[model samples]
Target chain A: MRLITLPILMLSMFSVSTFAEEHVVSQKNKSFSENKISINVGDTVHFLNKDPFFHNIFSLSDEQYFDLGSYPKDESRSVVFDTPGEIEVECAIHSKMFLLIEVKKSEDN
Target chain B: MKTLLFYFTLLVSQLSYAAETEPTDYTFIAGHPSLQQWLLPTPIPTPKDNPLTAEKVSLGKMLFFDPRLSGDNNMSCATCHNPMLGWSDNLTVARGYKSKALTRATPLIINLAYNNLQMWDGRIKTLEEQALAPMEAELEMHADLSQKIALLSGIDGYVTAFDNAFPDQGVNTKTMAMAIASFERTLISNNSRFDTWVKGDKSALTADEISGFKLFVDPVKGNCAVCHSPPNFTDDGFHNIGLASFGHDNPDLGRYNQRRLNLMKGAFKTPTLRDIALSAPFFHDGSAQTLSDVVEHYSEGGKVKTNLSPNFTANTLTPEEIASIVSFLNALTSPHKPFTLPTLPQ
Candidate 1:
């Protein structure tokens, strides 16, 4: 029973590492690098601030809600998309910056 | 000789037109590429749906100055946003709805055409969206939209004017807002001393004002450009600059009202400093009476440090530096143009 549990845990870890991917969206010139992007569920998106000032990126979408408190240049914050839907992201500081993310159901699911 | 005289006369007319319509040459700031961002783009941005037109501007001007639109028939858009008062009321807080003191100061509408968002807390997205807010607010204009529409429609002059401006739209709320926004778009303030300097005029700014500009952009010194950025002298961003009023119990939660986040608790929109000198009594609360007072507040970081904007920091600017910064701000004022009062449709 212990041997069977260990194999199952190892298989789950391998599956996550293989299926999940990461994407980077840069914040520069008071705008997001990508206006819209598509990624599978369970994938992570890193919001990198490339501007000189600070930016507070937040999303109140029902799919994935998050508030990445203001961070300065070269810093980055990330979030995992667990649900399959659209998420609209915006900067609390600069209203001009906006981003939309489409999370599709993973093929494995 | 007759043909030569005609050609010479045509040349003079063409030259005058070129002088008025030509784009500014930004080669003067070539030494500092960073300062290039300070130049405002010409032919002001306008929304696609609400394009500017002479008829619309004329109708909007009349509506903006006509007091009959208000509930008491005493207040117009120009009452609080007086052209003589730097497009603002010049009060600590606005007097709204029968001389009642408002919670916030009347913000100047100058150069709002360049803003991506509107209002102190950034609740509205466009000038068109914000045009009727004061009229709708109970503490403000307190005008019934249905009644105002009926009143305007009853006037034969207004009816013709609206038809001319909006074609098929008539005298409706949407057409009224679009017309007002079209006129507001014409309130451009890009011809300041700083603009002249950027346009290759070396004598536009004084020596001390130049030094002030340097300190204003330096991160360790005045550091004002972090939020009050270039072009329009605004980043179109929001920040909580730590005013003393933020410490009061049940203090105003500015941007947090729209976007619920800890960082936005006291955040307010960063206003354009294009005509900074003209619009006296600074900040949303109108606490700073002078530019010197404003510099002092920034030097001390802020009056209330809690929930302060991450972009702001304590500076060690000397008295001379502060004075110089204030001098630089004084140069931001554009020469006022004569505003003609529009005749209202009776």
Candidate 2:
């Protein structure tokens, strides 16, 4: 019974790792491609710049605050969602660009 | 003779139609399709809640020009944003309440309708949000809102004007801001020679001006368009374009006060270059004296490089290139139309 329980616990832990997903959000024409996106906790969001110029994506939100600095065209910056809450993201360079990220708890959790 | 005149009119109409139907895909300079982005959009953007009306504009103009709204019953918005002086005071730094010089230059009110953000720090999001800021600021107009409201409500002319403008809204700060914003929306500057050139008038700009324009867009050359983008000539972005002022102790942290980001420190909103030739003594600190001086600053890649904007890079533009760029900037000036002053309410 103990051996069976250990195998079941290992399978559950492996499933969580396997299920973690990555989402792509593009910055084009000084605006974020997605106005709002929903992602589960442990998921990663990749911010890709498609514009000719640079973009500095940052979020001052209490839930996962980050400043990606500035990256040029074709470059990408990523952030992993560890907390479950709404995050408001914006470009430091262009105030017009905004992205709202909704991080939800993983189904297993 | 009648037949000839009719044929001439028909021919002119056909030519106009042809010009209008011409594909926008055609490039201004060879290999630069991005130049088409320089055309300004028509019908200025306004909040749906506060649509522009003649009555509103009239009321706003009165409020804007009326000095009675100030704490001292003196110094109207026009005192700093004077129309004769390019909608700016032409002062190095703006003089606030009681003739105290403020830290930053009084930003021009030109083409503000297109901006999604307002003020040097972009602390405000709309012109309506920006209108009452000076009137309330301790160092600016410094008007006691309660007293000002009482005074305006007392005036029969103002009461009638406000009623005409806002109907059921009544005399209040919101309506005043909305009215002032409505008037400011009319301050559009999109008819410059460069605009004419963008509209396909090849003859509008001279050879030197065209060359200067090419240099302005060339990433390795002028690279001005990277920040001072198309149409309104602003990217609606903020940059810490390393001015000597940044080197000063306790330098103005500009956008950082609102944004609280390390990059935002010393960053300020990128001002429009539409009527660049008009407003002199440029930059937030009013550092540069002339267009040439402005170009020189960029050529040196800003004075203080410690926290320079990532977008800025030292360029190697020659004197000729600089002159041409300045000439191109001069082409951005729209012909000044005579402004009719609004009659103040007694």
Candidate 3:
């Protein structure tokens, strides 16, 4: 009974890691699926390139600004959210394609 | 039977090719009409009220070149928008009729057909409306409409053209703007190496040039497409790409001056990078001189931050890569331009 319970605890821990790990903001169908996303400061937001070509994930907004310059099709990038507040993400290639990420302050941090 | 099937497939493919060969309805592409393209969302639509006419366009062309429309002989609409200088005088700040009042001036006409709103502030709605500002502005063309109209009416050529162009409105400001704008409409740029490349011509660009184009369009490399987008090559949206002057003691609060939208504090309309190599000194102020300098500016992000453009991230572009991007920009120039330099009517 003890062994079975230990295995169950480990499985639950694995599931929890999968949930809170790098959250993907995919580029698909010509726009970001969800324009606004919420995440804790420590969590990473992965810019997953699901488009046919490439995408430049960059921003000028003060909350968070970094250009993950062009990544090819099917490539993915992860940025640990060190900064908190409203971060604007945009494709350098597709001007109209823009997104806002609300980076919440991590209670632990 | 197999040969017959192959022939049928060939015939179908040829027919589809023919259908696709029909020129796009985008006016920025010379012969094509601009009603369909521009920045996709901000397409310029003729007021369900004002459709196009060939005669109106012809008349507008004549009016655009005529200096009699100005209050002072020192300036005409063409004075600032000279064809020789890519329709812009290449000044950081435009001079008045006597080169006095220093105001920023951009190109005369770009993808106007696609713009839902006109001018930096989006104040003017129609070409006809935009036509009056220069003539009436104290420091611009500086002309009173009453005298200009009388002068125009006396000219037999102008009278005849106006009579033919607008049976009801004649050569009033609206008709005049319409005619001039129609003429401007004809000044679309196409047939660049980039256009050829887009149409599947493999030999249109060199290796470096192609890579530069890729960088311009790619999200990671140059990321220029965010504002200077494709097809007609303009987004018609506003951004504050951190131009240095924004942080000045007296800051120009760009679009925010109008709407007061927080994000628009230093935001200004995104200029098309199409034919960028030909149009000197980038930005609304005509500040940056060379294309490489322009790239370097973006690479370092914007110079100032007072009301900095939210899109301003320091785009990292290398020197050799910058040269290649410049070459690619040159490739966007139209091989065959529509309008020729007019011998100014003395």
Candidate 4:
């Protein structure tokens, strides 16, 4: 019975460790699909450009700074949040395109 | 027969409703509720970092009117952005320091508070950043900010004003910019006949003007609303509207210089149509002499099609429709009122 329980515990731990989440944020009609979102640290955000024009998504936030340079429609760029803090994201070309992400420390961490 | 009639009525009603609400198929019906979004909100947007105050406005007004801000101590901001000429110099292109002609026209300061980006190229992000640009530029105001601060610090009136505006911040370049930007924010326009028409006033515009508004929104017609969006009459986006100057050799690559994007080549920021009638000699190159000329330019789909905006296309508007659109533009200008110049501190 002890041997059986150890195998089950190992399988559960393996599954949990492999489960990193990804969120898709679309740039549609010159606006972000979600203005604000909350995610756990280590979660990756994929920014998909859905508009006809080119979009450059970037964040100058102290918590995480990244510039996903201009890409045409249907293209995407992603970034992983390693730090637990809020990040203000915006499009470099379209000034009005703005988004906020609040990253919390993961339970696993 | 009765069932068929009912279905037709339902279909017509749904189409009308969609046309009213959807910007994609925008249609202008008198006193439509959907048009109210064009009215400028009463509360202006100010950054959390630089919250507006009465002291800041007062100080900013003084700084804006002071020619001493310039290196030569002659030209003030008001020299080019004259309040009498719709906050523009009424020139084909702005004459900079020592009467040197600049490439671009002096954009009107009307409804700038609503703009997401500033300048013809959308280079400056905020008014605070824009306020000091002309003052520091060699061809423009040509003043050394540190030297200007020292001069202002020497003046007792300026020192007291700066102290009141930015307590403990003292007389510095940052405080001066904040103050000037604060004053500039007060230059807003939302009380036009067009605004009144949007606010459910059926009698605000004439029948011709109303017809012109329809053409303005129609995608196949003038389609002016595509770029000259409602409320402030600007999308705050850059576009190469196909001016003749764009065809020239080594033309000014407006937004391209900043972004280096192929689409941005020769593109300039879309100026607000609010009080546009007063800010004559229009376009980034100051090519269009009148509103009629501007309409014709759009109707022709631009002279230089090298990098024309996707929104701009050859429009087949009749002469009457052109006149009507021009008439509609006239309704955008608010009725003039007396403006008292700010008194400069000695």
Among all candidates shown, the one with the greatest lDDT: 2
**Model 2 chain B weakest 10-residue run by lDDT:** B17-26
- Winner by TM-score between candidate 3 and candidate 1: 1
Superior by lDDT: candidate 1 or candidate 4: 1
Best-fitting candidate, measured by DockQ? 1
lDDT of 2 by residue, A21-62 (tens): 756787877889899999898887778776667789999999
Cα displacement (angstroms), candidate 3, residue B30, comes to 21
What lDDT, from 0 to 1, does candidate 2 have?
0.85
In model 4 chain B, where is the ten-residue run with the lowest total lDDT?
A: B10-19
C-alpha RMSD of each candidate structure in angstroms: 13.8, 13.3, 13.8, 10.7
Residues B1-346 of candidate 2 have per-residue lDDT tens digits of 4333333433343234323322222355522455667878878888899999999999999999999889898989999999888899899999989999999998888999999799999999989889999999999999998899889999999999999998998999999999999999999999888888876777889999988988887778998888988778888999999899999999999999998888889999999998878888899999998999999899988988887778887798899999999999999999989888988877
The digit string of per-residue lDDT tens for model 4 on A1-77 reads: 33453354345333433445666788876799999999889877778766645676878788998888667655567
B124 in model 1: Cα distance from truth in Å?
A: 0.9
* lDDT, candidate 4, B1-346, per-residue tens: 4333333433343234323334644446656777876888778888888898999999998899899999899999999999988899889899988889998999999888889988999989899999999999999998998999999999999999998889899999899999999999988878888888877788999999988888887778998886787667776777888888988888999987876556678989988898999989899888888999999889888889987776566788899999999999989898898877777777
Q: Which pairs of residues have clashing backbones in candidate 2?
A: none
Greater DockQ among 2 and 3 belongs to 2
- RMSD, candidate 2, Å: 13.3
**Second chain only: TM-score per model?**
0.90, 0.91, 0.82, 0.92
The positional error of residue B335 in candidate 2, measured at the CA in angstroms, is 1.1
Question: Model 4, stretches more than 4 Å misplaced?
Answer: A1-29, A35-93, A98-109, B1-21, B24-30
